[model samples]
Target: MNRDRSLRYRLAGIEIFAILLALLFLAPFYFVLVNSLKTLGEILVDAASLPEAYKFTNYSRVWDMIRFPTALRNSIVITAISVAGIVTISSMTAYRLVRRPTRFNNLLFLAFISSMIIPFQSVMLQLVRVTSILELRGDLLGIVVCYLGFGLALSVFLFHGFIKGVPLEIEEAAVMDGCSPYGVFWRIVFPLLKPIAVTVVILNTLWIWNDYLLPVLIIGSNKDLTTIPLAVTRFFGQYTKQWDLALAGLAMSVTPIVVLFLLLQKHIVEGIASGSVKG
Candidate 1:
């Protein structure tokens, strides 16, 4: 039928546009990967062209130079702990804020939402002072704590809106079935939060894994606690620009994030679609 053909045409156009957009976003990665294999001389000459010989040695050199294994372990540890903490605490906090709706809860919710507007720079000094007082500086635990603080606001806000959309009747039914508060949340509510949880995981993982500023301010002296971003930064110096190592290190650093994003991208889209349907 004509209508079917028209629908097909529209879908085709949308797919084409979406693919174009995806390629546009991936352009930077292509540039980085290509240049990563090239020598500094080759990069300087023509970054776009393929290397005459793929110097995978750049990867090996950068790996050793930046203590890549240690950095990776630290990044994974920090990101995992920070993300898990954010998801657990924010989910509970948001659920309480929605279900309770007390004046104090409302005020607290407003505070979390409002905190998002404050730039990190404006509060950086005060944050340092607070961390020092709490003796949470110059340690891995300290940096993770910092991430939890900075990551909580946006995450709690997101969970607040999402939890509000989750039907109350389901929770009420769970309560009636002799489910305790914690049991109901863990058994019924939390399981239903898979979609939004994916979003939370991806967002927090990327931010915490790549974050350099907070780590520098908090635990920069602890070389053992340095993250991928910090390691890559220390790889570069003032007078001597090791473009070969820098480019290779950048490629290595971004690879995990790119892989994670791609792996979880489908879940994120599904989350959005499910949220729309629920709304």
Candidate 2:
């Protein structure tokens, strides 16, 4: 009886601790949301306190100042196209590597894995130079192509691990049923990859959506191609920080991605578990 009581107490304590930890992590979001409704002076004077007057105009002003609609459209186009390319190319590459463990394929897989370790910072100069030389700089295609190249290694690695767990007999059965290789892969293998694919989409979407640096470099001086992150920078200049407007812009920018993550969050764990077990 005493041991049972002790275990119950321990579990209750753990739950309480978890709640506090969650609140700690959520504190930044609290500040952002709260300050977003305040005036710049109010935010500066008492950032943690509630607004005396909720200046909702901050959002409207930020929206107009940043040309939010244009930025939103640019972000959507780039993220969607880049993620689609990443998913298609990575899955196909991973499938081929798993199906054919030839020396060349193995070497190629290693090369992809190795590339993942190279930091984007290290290649920034080269990236800018190469894109410029190819006349890809400042074009929509430029940023999309860069995203595809950088995103491929990690996506392929994830897909590779998950695909290994798939049974070879399934592919064989499809082949015997007179399915072409393409049909076997697309109809049979690809469908089974839904969990990992969703995971890939979510991860890459978050990365590409929030990304600022890549767009700055590749889409330089192109106001039409400005993304959310880039647009938000208007609130911060050399010395001044428009906290109210900046926070409002951040709140607006984060809402869609947050909704997306919450909706699909369950799949993240499922995909990782499935991949680890299968690999």
Candidate 3:
């Protein structure tokens, strides 16, 4: 009886510790949200207090100043295209490499994996110069290509791991049934890779959508083509800053990602966990 009571106590203690850790992680978000509703004066005076009066005007002003609708559209288009390209190319490449497992395939896979370790800063200057020479600077298409190149390594790495766990016999059976290589992949292998695909889509979507550095480097002078991150940056100047509007703009920027994660949270978690296990 005493041993069972001790086990119960230990379990209760663990539950309490987990609850505390969860609250600790959530505190910063609570701070951001509550302060977003407060006036500038209230935030400065007592950030912990609930807003004396909720100011919906901050969001409205931010929306107009940041051109939220336009920025949102640009981000969506860029994210969608970049993610689609990454998933399609990476999935096929990984599937082939895993199925064949030749020495050359292994070498190519290592090369792709090695690219991830090379820091972006090391190549930033050269990338800018090359893009300028190619006349790709300040173009959305240029930025999209850059995103694809940088994002491909990680996507391929993830897909390679997941593909290894998939059974070879399935593809063989499809081949014997007279399915073309393309048909075998599309009709057989691709559907089985749905989990990893969702994982890749979610990760790349978030990264590309929120990316500030690559877009800034590749895109210049084109206000119409500016992404949300670049547009929000306009609020911060060397001599002056629009703190209220900036925070509001950030909140607006974060809403879509938050909503997306909430909607796809289950799939994202399952996909990543299963992919990791298989990889």
For model 3 the local lDDT of residue 222 reads: 80
For each candidate, give its TM-score against the true structure. Answer: 0.85, 0.91, 0.88
In model 3, the runs with Cα more than 4 Å from the true position are: 100-103, 238-241, 274-279
- Superposed by TM-score, candidate 2 places the C-alpha of residue 190 at a distance from the truth, in angstroms, of 1.0
Maximum-TM-score candidate: 2
Scored by CA lDDT, what does every candidate get?
0.86, 0.88, 0.84
How would you encode candidate 1's per-residue C-alpha lDDT over 131-218 as one tens digit per residue? 9999999997888788888888877887888888899999899889989999988899998887788777777776788777888999
Per-residue lDDT of candidate 2, residues 1-279 (tens digit):
999999999999999999999999999999999999998888889999998876789899888887889989999999999999999999999999999999999999999989978988999989999999999999899999999999998789899988999999999998999999999989999999987898788778878999988899999688889998888775565225878888888899888778877887788667656645643
State the lDDT of candidate 3 residue by residue for 1-279, as single tens digits: 999999999999999999999999998777777777777777788867777878878889879887899889888888888889889988988888888889999999999988878998998899999999998888778888888888888888888887788898998998999999999999999999887888889878878988988888888578777788888787664214455566677888888988988998998788667656754
In Å, residue 152's CA in model 1 sits off its true spot by: 1.7
- Looking at model 3, residue 74 earns an lDDT score of 87
Pairwise TM-score winner, candidates 1 and 2 = 2
